[model samples]
Target: MAAVDQNSLRKLVEGQLLRLEGNAFQDCMDRLGLVLYPGDYQPVRAAGPKGDTKNDGYCPKARVFFAAHATRGETFAKTKGKIRGDLEGCLQEHRDVKVWRFLTNDTLPGEVDQFIDNTLRPLYPDVTIEVWGLKTLADEISKLKQGQVERIIDVITVDEPEFEVVVLNHMKTGRDLWPVLSNCLGWLPHEEPHDCTDDEQDLIDSAVQSFRDWSDISGDIEFSRFSVRDAQRSITAILEELAEKRLGLYAATTDDYPLTGGPSPFLGTVAIFRIVRVASE
Candidate 1:
């Protein structure tokens, strides 16, 4: 697939920020918080008769509080007053705050920046204050994962055409198969595994080092006469030999595997390999 145009995406996000205000702006920020912190961002819901908690969201892990003030043609003084009041209320209610982020829909005025730096910082000597205007919000949203960003904002992506297929019957072998598979097939490595256990991490590290060692000694395995049919025959032969020796690798050939509904147009005949992590079974 074609990579997302980050510059264009950021501009779109900034434009959205400029347009949205009040509850809509607050909701957008909440969605961004969810994407940014994943499970860590806790959004403060509606306030009762006692009035709002001032904090729109809080990330407990980072001890960061978010207060959104979206203006709808409000004056500089009015905007500043709202921000100052929210900060005071949030500080009072949430004493453990290390960073208080003030989120706004539009670019902050010079006087607003001065007020926060000179007036607010002196009042709250311990807590750090941050202002996230349209540009700042756009920059942050742009850096997030493509999938996460897609959930928050409208995105248009180019579709991938005719990709070489890798059908692993046993998918748990994970990306340890990438180096060898990438050499055999034309599959390019894309994503990395996240939150791996110690043992899994060790295996990944060892696999990487092994690939490096092999490359340094024998150099990269290149198939100058590489073709889809030739690759299929080679893989099938290898897997069948392993199976015969009871080395725990299995192979199956089928034309039923779905790529764009039924079998890939690129690889004519599909061969699926089941890789088992065992000497014999």
Candidate 2:
């Protein structure tokens, strides 16, 4: 068998990631108790794409102005500048925007972290700026079960199950199907993501993805809730660990290394963490 092109596979994966990022972004916000009104990207327009008036979205629950940028091939530093520009534009144009929710396909880099902290937070002191980057996207994908991944693979990869049914029918009729089946099954020619025509792929992808995204109205709601809770826990863990170290450092502000340094009552609190880590190791 010929080796599949890694670059094509990557492009395919990135395409899917970007397309799904919006819903996943909404899911994360929902988990944080912010409910975005279902709508389009551009502001309240008379007619939305495909005759749908609701293409963009707004979060009344958080009073946020949401922006989705599924940038495929950009460094985080470049993306950060773009985001800063967009957020500045939003603030300049929309007086009602209380929170700036920026979602991107690129992972957040240290430059972006500094931008958010030293730039965004300080400059936009009156408004809240939240970013959902590639790591967040990965975490959302991680919550998808092995089963979910397989189900999607089954839907998009090939017509194996259909061919299996054909084999079963042949067996029932007691036909000599060895040569015929052998050639057909050989290499198990599969549908790569790029193989499907756009329309056909969209139909299959949407049906299968919808099955995963929305099993039923209730199941769909449950799936979103599960995603939200899972993401919240992941974010909380990172934030809490940072807060712990910062708290320790604050307690021993004068110490050379408050987190691992000269005596302070919070030192024992820090010590306990070290002991736990060593024990686990």
Candidate 3:
């Protein structure tokens, strides 16, 4: 089988892996060197021994069994619990397969690593269990391919507001996006306003034009509405780009500068955005 594309790999993790038929997952696991147990069937719902639940695959050469945990209901802890039960069933049939490899399509809470150490590891002291969460796939894929990883990180946050949430899985280990992003904002200056050189002004002008290109300029335009809307979209596009690349952007209204000569009340303000990451976990 051909190597899986980035989009398929992304779909497997961030997308609907459960929707995938057994063969699709089998192919993906195969890329990672795991051979399916019931070689003739798909993995999504392949059956194991009569009493045991379905086992995705097993690499007989390495004494390892593969299981797919497609649960998005909660964190990896919940997923891990379910896998433990599956393992118990499988162990009844094949006690010789000591390694259990779980592939998950969910974001794991930071404490999950220690949980594995304290819980799963202690329970199966002789057996080795491995978890492949969002971060793990990204790490493995990056190592397999050379530089220029197609999928950097998966952002999984629907909770916690006070914290600027970031998972280092998508983090560009050798580079930073802040300076690159700052260069994209024309209105923002890298140095003091008065100290900008002619070349710097050219760069700023080029960025302004690039932002203008993002706007849908059709028909007669209200300059105020156009400028502000374009600015808003400019901010949005840059933010989305950064986020897609595993970078975080945070913005809050700061200052408002009132425009003159217009009979309208159009307040202009300078907003700033920054790249973010989790400093603690």
Candidate with maximal TM-score: 1
For candidate 2, the TM-score is 0.36
Q: Looking at model 1, which ten-residue stretch has the lowest summed lDDT?
A: 257-266
Which model is ahead, 1 or 3, in terms of lDDT?
1
Give residue 276's lDDT in candidate 1 (0 to 100).
46
Clashes of each: 0, 5, 5
lDDT (Cα atoms) of all candidates against the true structure: 0.60, 0.40, 0.45
What tens-digit string does per-residue lDDT give for candidate 2 at 1-281?
A: 11212222222233335444445534433322221233423343225443222223455544577666665567777777777877876676556677787766666667777878898889888888887675554344334443343232121232212211111111111022112221110112222233445754454444323222221122223347565444334434433443333311011011111111112211110000100111111
lDDT of 3 by residue, 1-281 (tens): 11333432333233323333435544555445422233432333444446324466666555777776555556566755777777776676675867887776555666766777787779778889888875565446545442222212211222211323323223231123222222221122222234445764464445434433432221123346655455455555654544453444333322332211123222232223333432433
**After superposition, which runs of candidate 3 have C-alpha atoms over 4 Å from their true positions?**
1-27, 34-45, 48-54, 75-77, 145-281
What TM-score would each prediction reach against the true structure? 0.53, 0.36, 0.41
Per-candidate Cα RMSD to the true structure, in Å, reads 16.1, 24.9, 18.2
**What's the ranking of the predictions by TM-score, best on top?**
1, 3, 2
Candidate 1 on 174-248: residue-level lDDT in tens? 233323443221112222245545764564454434432332222124343344334434444544543453334
Look at candidate 1 and tell me the lDDT of residue 133.
Answer: 87
Off by over 4 Å in 2: 1-15, 18-56, 138-281
**Compared to the true structure, candidate 1 yields what TM-score?**
0.53
